[model samples]
Target: MTPVPGDNPTPRPAADAPGAPAPGTAQPAAAGGPLRTGRPKPWHVLWLLLLLGWTVSAADRSVTGPVVTWMIDNGVGFMAHADHPHALGGLIGGLFFAGYMLTQFPGGYLGDRYGHRTMVVVSLLWAGLATILTGFLGGLIAFIVVRVATGLGEGAFYSNDRTLITDNTPPKDRSFGMGVCISGLAIGITIATIFTPNFIDFGRSVLSDIEAWRMAFWVLGAATLVVSLAVTWFFRTHLKAATVGKAALHLGAYAVVSLALIMAVYLIGDSTGLSDLWIAVLEVALAVGLVLFVLVRKGEEVGPVLKDRDLFIIYLCNIAILWNLWFFSFWSVSIVAGAAHSSFAASALTAGFNAGAGIIGFPAGGWLSDYGLRRGWGRKEMMLTFTGVQAVLTVAFAWYLSAADHPSLWVMGLLLFFASLFFNALQPVGHALTAELARPDLRGSAFGMQNLIGETGAVLAPAVGGALRDSTGGWTAAVWLDAGLVVVGFVLLAQVRGRRAVSPV
Candidate 1:
């Protein structure tokens, strides 16, 4: 590829090169030659584009969560029976992830082949349109179809956006860049919490007949369109080409496994009996299949592993981190509301937890990760330490919740703040691990796999929490179960060992 007319063409050593200097280390210049500095060329424009794309993607996906109850209230109900609302809701909501998981490998491969920028722009526009359609339509079939389309569009956006950041940033700074970009995810969710209620209120006040929930969708769609245009305008250049063969194989394999598992579950459950045990077995099988699919794809030699065992351990810690983070998003509000002595207090607690995490914890995590990288501490170590502390805090909070008759809101809030802090810190560490392990050509696939694994927690947490709560008779059991999972995740991290070779900033 020809360099742009004024752009420098001088090739620098790749950050993951055998003996690349650590972030803070200085390289000696050649005798009488200008010093070979390590600072990265500014990519502010690209970073902003990445952030905009990510924020829109995340907002579109999560906005449904806050507005589902409103949708049900406004006569667009999922089912006639109250008993089946959760089951139907789960099925409807899970469809988006089903589509998302289905498309990830293909999206990653497409980004590698066609260019990350191209796939991102296309995905943004596609999802924006689908989101708009979702607002205008009603009924179960329409909801399901539009959700699937939104999933496909969003699946493409996440995979390609990660690839773009990985391709554009130097290795040493990749984690920091990724952290900054994904912080948009946290920001979007936060904005939804703050703004969605007000938007709904405005719609209700102005237009008595129109469902405010529908209006929220319209507004979200408009915002998505604007962001999509911004991304297209700013990220016009294709920096790295894609690889089609590997992406196709990986994508095909996942699709086959997912379809087979879903079919198997349906057939077995619908057959002789619909025992809880049989349903449980089917869910476990589906989960296993998903994991195996990722393992097989990752094992295909698409990327290089950091020689250090510790780096791999760090990755494990990140998986744990993601598990806890998602667990809270799925269950924290429900638990609080269920336990709240008063309905108003419960509402306030839920709002406070989200506000604190989104506003304070997310940015802090990125800042700390960047600080560690700049100071020459291993990013992996930072992740491990933070997650380990999180596990302890979670256990303590669970115990408190279990034992207390009327826990103080202030105390609960403090624990939640700490949990959010540790949870958010893991993002940069995960990104750094990918940067350390992936070869430049395969970075997209590597990051895609990381995201796939991390998000599996999203799929499992709600189901697991619900089951535990049902079996044990309250939210306390669910909290303990989550705490235990976090600890087990820490143990997994303990197995990773080795130091990564530092890359240039």
Candidate 2:
């Protein structure tokens, strides 16, 4: 693939190369040399700003759990008086992931073909607008559809963000940069868990409980828009030049097709009263069809990305990671509240402990991976260790919940915090490994394809976990199932021989 002028991949430099500083610290100039000081480097600027982007994106998605929980408790909005309320709520999350899953590869392809910066900017704008729309739209169907649209827009972010960071940072610090940028994910989750309920309560003072959650969405959406403008301004000089006509012909067309596919599943299920399981299966079928279509149209280009067995393993392992991730992200508040018999505010705070772990876990894991490389270890080892540890913690948490009539809230918080530390750590380690495994030029598509396959787990986890919870009448079964899947992911990852050495620029 031909590189766009401003988005060409930067060659990775070897760690031992002179002038390379340790992962996070700045290098001092030679002894008696003048101090090197001025504006922050471009990579630093991108990393910091991208952290904000990830924060808002996370805040937008993480708000769902608190809002959904509020609805269920207050007997308001979509979950009010619904049979199998958890199932309905989970399905909403599942549908969002379905749209997110379908767009992964195509979004990455567009990022690679045009420019990562352009797609990154586009995604933020699209997500911000769609999120704001959700605040204004009423009813279940409207809410679901708008959330799906938001998912589609946000899907472009991961692949491009990873690619962009990898291109800008040296290989030594690449993982750390990616981790720091994504640390916002944990922060966003923390913010949502602790503050979203507050936002709703604040909204309640002026509006009905049914409509109060809209205020949370509106606040997050506006924050996202503000970040978009900041990014556009900061990246003005580096953005790829594209005509309005070209954008319409390419991105516009892609958006229309992707939305149509997602909506088709929603419409079919709605009209037929199909089970959530069947709806998810149908969405997976559509996703598979979309991939097959892409392969047929661009076989030669797509073939290289698909041919790696290890990459496929990594992709599959991510299914477990994401499954466990959204399972908690979508339901942790409810899980905590139900198990501990605590108030929504207290439960959210406890769950926030889990999400907050990521703030430390993400960067710590990345730094550890980088440190491991220097000591002859690899990203695979870091991922395997964290996955195994988290699996144990998950099972323990599940057991505690099942054994106690009212699980101790403090114990629950501690378990979640430790488990999530490992869980969140695995993310940056996995991304670093994926980048190491992929060719530089194809990194965008590779990351996209990774998420496209991994998100199958995301699509199924929420609805399936919810179904299990509803059927079993407790979160114990759902939590155990989550633990089992992560173990499966660990086994899959053990088969991967991730390359640790980088070719010097």
Instruction: Give per-residue CA lDDT, model 1, range 1-505, as digits (tens).
Output: 2222111233343222323332212221211123237632433345566777777777777666556534433444454443434334434444555556556656666666655666677777877887888887767667766775676567766766765555555454566666677777766665654466666777687655445566767788889999987766554343222332344344445445554554456446747666333453454456556546555765555434323354445444544555465455544554665555444324434544643464455455656766776776766677678778878888888988878898766677778777766766666666666655566566566555555545555555544555555556667876787788788887776665534444344
lDDT of 1 at 344: 30
lDDT of 2: 0.81
Structural similarity to truth (TM-score) of each candidate: 0.77, 0.91
Q: Weakest 10 consecutive residues, lDDT, candidate 2?
A: 23-32
Model 1 spans with C-alpha error above 4 angstroms:
1-41, 69-76, 84-91, 206-210, 239-319, 341-349, 355-363, 467-473, 498-500, 503-505
Expressed as tens digits, the lDDT of each residue in 1-505 for candidate 2 is 2212222223222211223332222321211123247634445667888899899998887787788778888888878888888888888888888888877898788877766777788888888888889988878888988888888888888898988777666567778878899999899888988999889988889888679989999989999999988987766654545632353257657767877888888788868998776787788788888878888999998777787899989988988988988889889999999898899999999998899999999999888878787777877888899999999999899889888876898999999999999999889988988988887677889999999988888888888888888888888899988988988888888999887664322
